[model samples]
Target: MIGAGAAGLATAIFTGRSSPHLKVLLLDGARRPGAKILISGGGRCNVTNSSVSERDFWGGRSTIVRHVLSGLPVAETVAFFGEVGVPLHEEPGGKLFPDSNRARDVLEALLREVERVHAHLLTAHRVVGISGARGGFTVDTLQGSIAARAVVLAAGGQSLPRTGSDGAGVQLAQRLGHTIVETTPALAPLRIGRADGSFHERLSGVAHDADLTVWADRQVLIRLRGSLLWTHFGVSGPLALNASRHWARAALEGRAPRMTVSFCPGLRFDDADARLVAAARERPRAAAPTVLAAWLPASVAAALASEIGLPDVALAQVPRDDRRRLSHALVEWPLAVEDTRGYNYAEATAGGVTLGEIDPSTMESRVCPGLFLVGEVLDVDGRIGGYNFQWAWASARAAARGLATTL
Candidate 1:
């Protein structure tokens, strides 16, 4: 196994533990493994979600994703963690975190499991290149070289390069004859230009529930509803991060994509207008800002009323056109998103090795025999809330089973 990160660790552990007679050597370029894991979920380490399915992911074929995940479902994953001494507890959105609430505990437990299975993990063995065909393969690393019967590439994607997953695995796969989908930032914060009138900048540090939608040209591409945090840079919460992949992928494909947010999550323009109308009727003496504050923050309501030229008007005194405009702004507010924070801040990568080239049932390369691809290196990325971690575990299990069959 090359790259002893999340998927690499899981794959090595499953392979070694299941087949004790086989010698397992997991190599990682980093001096210390699991940097990403350690930093994930705000250092709590969301191990997996209580609920997961192929529909929770994007990229490649859904059928392929479903097949791989079926090998070890979320139930099995929870059970596996329990078997390794890491009990999980559920949080909002079904995210499961370690009972100890420490990422180090998760990593240490995996490392202990790897040792218990007698798998030899060598750190700092950066694989520079791989040569030779299936029956016999030679992996060249910065530290040294090793001969192996089969190789699993789990070096991860180009997110958080300092964590040691700097797209090296993608390059290695290309040399071995594999089609790579163009990769881009998936769960990354969006950088907003002054195009949106700098309202977001002024609202920095404010968080609220919202529905974010990305449009490709004029078509609605995708939508996600979650907590949105207004950062000094722009938006950095779950809603913006989860919707980033659609924007990044659309931009990479040369399409103009626009992002809009509905502060009233499930309300449409008509619904918001009716709501405002009802509020105005019910409280005729209330000032516009005061009435708007019923649905938004006082600061936001005051700001919006001031920006829309209804700052001092009473709710009933406001014109119908002006009220409708405010409703539109509340429901379909367009954001001038310039670009995302990129891989440096991305939690996962959008595109990777095409799934068509690999057998979904086993994650074995159809182009190159004995070459297994797993984890973020493949064309699979999930929304925030532990979906990507689930992918890592499930795909690793599939690849380990594949290795068992072939080697």
Candidate 2:
């Protein structure tokens, strides 16, 4: 094992338990294991999803994800964690977290499992190079060189460099004749450039529930509905984070994707227009912002009203053109995203080693015998929530089973 993260630790635990006669060694560059796990889910590790499917992942082939997930489904993951003494509880959107609500608890459970299986864990051992053939392999680390019959690369992706995943695995795979897909930051905040009289600058720190859509070359790529947060430089939150992958990919291809957010996701354009008109009649003396505040946040309503030049105008005194403009702004507010916050702020990486080069059932490399690629090192990334962690668990299990067979 070339990492000691969620995937690498799981692989070491399973491989050690399943094949006790064979020794399993887990190496990490960091001083401690599961550095990313400690910070995940706002310090409450989202261990897995209550429900999981290949559709939840982006990049690579869905069939590959399906095969790996089938080997260790979500239910099995839950049961496995329970056996490890980390009982899980489900939250909204089927996200499962340790009942203790501390990421340290999850990591502690994994470390306990590793110790139980008698797996050797070496921290501060960075793999500098790997050279091997079919029968034997030599892994060169900063500490020293170790020989093994098989090797599993679970070093993860380029996201969260502070956690030790700094794209070294991708470079290693490339040297061993594997194709690496162009990687980009996914599940990160989208940066909004200064537009003429930018409302985002004035509305920084505001959050609201909205429907977000991604458009590339006038074509709608995807739609997400969730909380949208405005920052001084960009937009973030569930909706923006979910849509970041599509936007980043489009930008990488030289296509500028536009993000359109609808403040009232449940209301149609005509319905919103009618509602504004009805509110004007019902609260004739009220300002337009006040009427909008009934459904939206007061700050948001004020910002939108100010954007349309009707910040303090009475609802009844508003012109028909201004009413239509306000309705349109609420329904289809578009923002030209400058770029994402990049890998430093990204939760996961979108691309990795191409799925076609690996056997889906075992996660073994077709290009190199006895070499397995698992977790975020492969071209598999899931949405926010517990899906990515579930991928880590499922892929690790699949790789462990395959490693056992080789042993």
Candidate 3:
């Protein structure tokens, strides 16, 4: 067993219950296991997404996820935790967490299960090398080398390197003849304005619930709904991160993707135009910014007014052209991407080992026997909420089962 994160921990729990005589050993590089779990969901730790479907997951082998996840159902995973004494509460959008609303509770629950099953947990220990063939394998760690019949790589992704996942596992997998997808920051923040950009320093810290869209080379990409955060550096939050994968894809192909925010989600252009005309009639004497401020943040309203060349004129005196322009800007606020925040701030890695290289049914490397890859280390990543946790649970369960059976 490798790693002690959601995937690794869940694997231990299941494996411990499945075959107590297997002598499962979970090795983690972190001194404190579940560091990511501690800070997940702003410290609450979203456990799993309730609205899980095959469409929710995207990657080279998305179809593979459906089959893999079906084998280890979400209901069973939730029930497994429940049977272990951890009550769960679900938030809007099907995100689940411990009833206590503390990530530490989730960690403690898993830790208690590991202890109960007598699973050996060695923290602050790093595996430096692995060598062997056939049914026997040797895992060389900082402390010492241990012999095992199988090994599972659940060290997670390069994102949140502070949590102890720094891509060491990638190099190790490569040595074993597996191809690793060029890893990049997946669901990370997008850098919008610089000190010189028009929107620079204008709306930092201002948040608004809006529909975000990303496009590259005239192709519509990701679209999602969430609150966006304007920072001194750029734009962030769930919507921004969700669109980042598309941005990264565009950049990799030498094309920069631009983003647009729709404050009026699901509204047709004609409807938005009509709304603007009505606002102008009701507050004709008001400044264009003031008119817009009724529906948007004051800073955003002012910025949009400027972008549309409204000149801060009173709505009553504004020309029809200017009014039309303001309507366009309000409906579609365009933001150019200066760049992404890189892996340092990403919540998860987007790309990794291709799904074809691993057995989706068992999460074992089809390239190598007794070897498994799971978690963000693979190309599998979910939208914000608890989908990522679902991946962790499903992949870990499948891998652990394979390891137990093989050993």
Candidate 4:
């Protein structure tokens, strides 16, 4: 085993337990294991998703996720943890967390299980090279070379480098003759360097609920509605981050994507326009700030007004063009994309080992026998909310089950 992150840990755990007699050596570059798990979900460690289904995954064979997850279902995952003494609680968004409400609890549970199963976890052992063929594999590391019957790359994605997913495993896969999809940041904050630049700089602490969408060349690309936070550089939170994956990928292909956010998504455009018109009519003497205050945050509304060239215009005496601008602002506020913040800011990376290279049932590389890829290392990225963890669990299980023939 190489890279003792979530997928690596889970893979080792399952493989070790499935065959207690087999000696499994788990190698990780980090000093402590499960660093990502420790900080995931703001320390709550969203272990899995109740909404886990094939449909949640992005950019891969949808059926593959179904097949793998079917073999190691979420219920079984919950049960596995339950047996290991970690009681889980489900949040409103189908997100599962430990009853202790601490990320360390989830990490500790997995660590305890690994220990119980007698899996030898070698931490701080950075693997420099993986050699040998098929059932004979030797991993050269910082400490020393350790030979294994099989090699599983669960090194995770480049996102969260502090967690030890530093794109090293991708290089290993590439050297092993696997086709790697162009990797870029996904589930990251969308940055607007100009136009909304000042607002971006000052709106760091502001958060609002809205529907955000991204478009490329007048074509709608991604749409998500959820809580979004305005930051010093750009937008974060659910809607922005979810839409960001598509935007990041699209931008990488040389097509600059445009972000369109509906501040009032629940309201129809016509209804919103009429409401604005009515607000002006009812309060002919109403201040512009007062009229729009009800619809948006004071700073956000003021910024919108300025962006649409209506900053000085009175609400009651608002000109036709200004009203139209306000309507447009409310409907689809445009933010140009320069580039994504990259994996450092990403919750996940969108591209990896192409799904076609591996058998969905086994997660084994068709390109190389005894070589398995799991978690974000593969082209299987999911939307936010425990979907990535589900991928880790499912893909890890698939790899372990496939290795059962040898173990």
When summed lDDT is taken over every stretch of 10 residues in candidate 2, the lowest stretch is 194-203
Write the residue-wise lDDT of candidate 1 on 1-407 in tens digits: 99999999999999987778888999999999999999999999998998898999999999999999889988999999999999999999999999999999999999999999999999989999988777799999987789999999999999999999999999999999999999998999999998677788778888888899899989999888999988878898998998999999999988899999898999999999998889989998998789878778787777677766764678888888888888988888888899999999999998989999999877899988988999999999998989999999999999988888888
Cα lDDT of model 4 by residue, 172-271, tens digit: 9888898989888888887777865576667677888888887877788877789889887788888788888888777778676888788887776788
Candidate 4 C-alpha error for residue 229, in Å: 0.6
Best by lDDT: 1
Candidate number that wins on TM-score, 2 or 4: 2
- In order, what lDDT does every prediction score? 0.91, 0.89, 0.81, 0.83
Backbone atom clashes (below 3 Å) for every candidate: 0, 0, 1, 0
Where model 1 places Cα greater than 4 Å from the true spot, the runs are none
For candidate 2, the lDDT comes to 0.89
- Give a tens-digit lDDT track for model 2, residues 280-347: 99999999889989989999898888877874669888989889899998988888688889999999
Candidate 2 Cα RMSD (Å): 1.5
Highest TM-score: give the candidate number: 1
Q: Whose lDDT is higher: candidate 2's or candidate 4's?
A: 2
Ranking by TM-score: 1, 2, 4, 3
**Predicted candidate 3 versus true structure: per-residue lDDT over 333-376, tens digit per residue:** 78777788988888888778778898887788888788888887
Q: After superposition, how far is residue 388 of candidate 4 from its true place, in Å?
A: 0.8
When 1 and 2 are scored with TM-score, the better candidate is: 1
